[model samples]
Target: MQSISELLKFLTGTVFAAMPRDMLRELVLPHGHVALLSRRRADMIISRVRMVAGLFAVLTPLWIVIDLLVFSWPVTGLLVAGRLVTTVAFGMLAVSFRKSIRMREAYKALAMMFGIPTLFFIYSHPLLSHFDMAGPAAAIAAGYAFLPFVMIAGLAVFPLTATESAVFAMPVLCAEALVALLQLDMLNWSSHLGAFWLLFLIATVAALAGMSQLSFMMSLVRQATHDGLTGCFSRTSGEELLDIQFHIASRSGAPLSVVFLDIDNFKKVNDTYGHDAGDRVLRTMTEKLRSNLRSGDVLLRWGGEEFVILLPNASGATATSAVTRLRDIGLGTRPDGDPVTASFGIAERIADGVTDWHQLVEIADQRMYEAKMAGKNRLVGCADPIQYEAVVNA
Candidate 1:
């Protein structure tokens, strides 16, 4: 019973977490995936959509031919030619997706890809004067009824949300009704109602799939980029951010600085107390440091006891001041209310000689080492009096 309850709880949490909230915003207001979702997640989803749409684009025309030739399905020659043309266009949808597309454009392009095929397959569902094809007609109608499910299967595989799937579904459902009405020379109440219920069911399933995939993607990125213990940016994420900021600063002529901080006697804390206490200290210290930093400034857990700060548009003085503020705050007394201090090293980029961001970090790291050598709880910094003068002289 306990195991069953735990399993049920897990399932419930997953269902809620994976619900696609973005679909609500997107259906009402369309925007690029970058604007709509996290840029990394958007890119991943778009890649998957391109692959699925491409496969569909290639195989759809062939499927149409197979049905006509092997199954001897009744389709007008004119309709066949039109479907071929549509196939060429559909193939382009896949091709278009092969490259990077923003969130908004991808949604739009994929919806069209999902919908246009339904329009092409709209055959008049005429009441047969002869009963011989009744079995075939019923089979076709059932298959047509399942088209929304087919459309939504792509939604499950791709990063498409329920609303986007709905956009594709609306056209197909409408086409199904139009064809049905035209076939019987009257409105088929059963067919219309069936389409409505099926759409609702399809939407629910599609939304669940979309939300689940989104949650999975977000979790993956978070785990990849953040330190698990302190929830600070990992060393890798910090380096990537530094590289990006370096290019931006170089292009925009903005100053950039790095601060390297080492927790004093962190190993002593771990040995004296325990690993758990050390973890508490790290998490608490990171929280305090985060409170002192700006949004654009990133704090990375460089290693076990060292943290690095990347400051875009900041000078060496700014980096020093920031570290001073950290020192002033006392970095939050440890869990036992014992004082804990950290040593700091600072480095800044200059126009005089443009060095790689890594070199700039290494300079700060060396300065941090110098501080440790000089005394455990202190700051060592290297800053030019006229910071950008070297740039001017250069």
Candidate 2:
């Protein structure tokens, strides 16, 4: 009995080991995979729609030929039925595509609704009475369903935790199992095996092309909008964000604050400690500022050794306090024991005044210079224009 139990345990372990790595991965690790799958699924659906549109363009004419030459009357009637069914399916898919574009439905929901149902319709067609037609249809369905599973499995190549791999892989494994069952039940196993393989090959090629394009586009967007050094928004991008915030604040009559920060004696640091140390100090200071700021606040690397913070729905007092906190944090030491300090200029948009985004930036920049002139490590500029001038003069 002990030997039999041990044998059973070993058999179970071997069976699990024999299973596809993707199936195992989804079962083990899932959130990042799920998010990634969700995005990819949405993209796949859009691509599928385009492919289907092209297919329909070609098939519509071929469908006419099949109706005229092959089927005669009853088959022609069935052909009409199939065409109608396909038309309705394409229409529904079009609607789903529009919704996906608008982000109205999750990709999983769209796939379940449009993708799965379309597969069912394709499998159920009577016009696929011919071996050639039936083979291609089955292949297409298998490829469509199986490709998602394959892509989901590729997530294992990423550095996911065990639990995450399991969780993500489970849904994908289920999807693959469903496809396998679909292949067994829906396909004309004897005649169209070649078509099934062809479809799988096509699906793989198409998915690779689609994902490659998406990755390139995402990389371009990141490079254009984000800073190379600190991974925050670039100065221009930050200004665009400020324009958005300014519009929102103007519409709501809420105050928007701009904080300009310049590293105190940053040139001196580069001269004394070297440029590498200066870079380290800037990186450390930005990280500190990011940690201290509120979630709503936007931080940007606004030129060399300078950063800009945009605070929406913040009054002059609140802006001053926040900048003061950031100022204190920026003046702290780096990991290599290099001391760093920053001077900040805080300015809030005047209510019902001619306060454009550029003007606000100008005011903040002027005040930041004032803070630097006064001392190396202080927060300044909470006073009215008249008082600000008086203080500057004093």
Candidate 3:
């Protein structure tokens, strides 16, 4: 039985690791796990917002129908009509958002998109004035049905962090209970307090469970996509990022540049000193390169002694200039005072061209080989792979 449980856990973790990148990046970690995460890590905020909006779009209208049928709608005709119209409109907008996502509009649109439904959820009790006639006991019982809805809503949030869930739930419960106390005269103010507190406790527990699920997803994603050695992106994740940026650049007619770099005589270092020294050199070089990159640039540990860089909206010449600076500041020297340096090759996507991301990487890689042949510690950047000169820049 214990073995079976362990196997199940492993499988569950594998499934989480295979989930979408856009979804995983926004997940919150457990308490004391904050040290394991980078708060400044870039998130696919637009993609996540679209996913959330798409879910609510499908859910809100269905909720409208359910409320009208299950709850007393006749006495709340105007409120029902308004809510139905609002939900349908939100659904329509969400459908449009799905087709082509754009930035700068994400935060505002997502705010309005989520804000409308949340406000409706809060004021729903006031809208259902008939709950007063249903008696306090019946009204309170019906309110409990919303617990499932609340849990479902947590999915839209993705990572319902520990305190975050309560932060969102408290207001809705308090508003509902307060409104119920006012409408259902049979429930005294004190009676409403007990209901509110009870629901708060229940919702917090459910929300925390939801958050734990998200944290589990994060752990798997981090393990699968991040390189354990240098804490850089794994090659698989790097490829995904390249594809995403390629499509973006294709649409915008922006240049997408890729650079392939190799540490000069890395094997010599390992054979001469030790594997531990080689690892230290890799970590140090990775940090130096990473710090000098622009905010949007991506760095990947392509393999041992090799790294790949993606520079969106940069041309080959522009990228060459940037990497030359890196060569200038390359690992100054090893523990034994031997000089450390790296070689680079750069390629850029031409506008309205037929080249693919893989092709671009290949071109850069070929130039990297040329750099190795041209006496090492140099860089090559050109549209033609074979024609690029492995110029000594360091």
Best by TM-score: 1
Candidate 1 Cα errors over 4 Å, as ranges: 1-13, 17-40, 66-75, 93-149, 159-190, 241-257, 271-276, 292-297, 311-324, 334-338, 346-357, 370-394
**Position 364, candidate 1: lDDT:** 84
Q: In each prediction, how many residue pairs overlap at the backbone (N, C-alpha, C within less than 3 A)?
A: 5, 20, 0
Report the lDDT tens digits of candidate 1 across residue range 1-394: 5865575466546755543574345323334222214456456766765666667667767756544643333443443565577777676766674555356565666666666666555532332212244455446534544555576556666544445556655676676566556554233577667665666556556655665665565556667888999988889877777877787788888889888889988888788889999998998889998988986788889999999988888877777777777777767666566677777888888722447899888988988888788766777776642111111113
* Estimated TM-score for each candidate: 0.66, 0.53, 0.62
- What range of 10 consecutive residues in model 1 has the weakest lDDT sum? 385-394
Candidate 2 TM-score over all chains jointly: 0.53
Q: Identify the runs in model 2 with alpha carbons over 4 angstroms from their true place.
A: 1-64, 72-224, 236-256, 312-316, 334-339, 347-360, 373-376, 380-394
RMSD of each: 7.8, 10.1, 8.9
Model 3 steric clash total? 0
Flag clash pairs in model 3: none
**Model 2 accuracy (lDDT, Cα):** 0.58
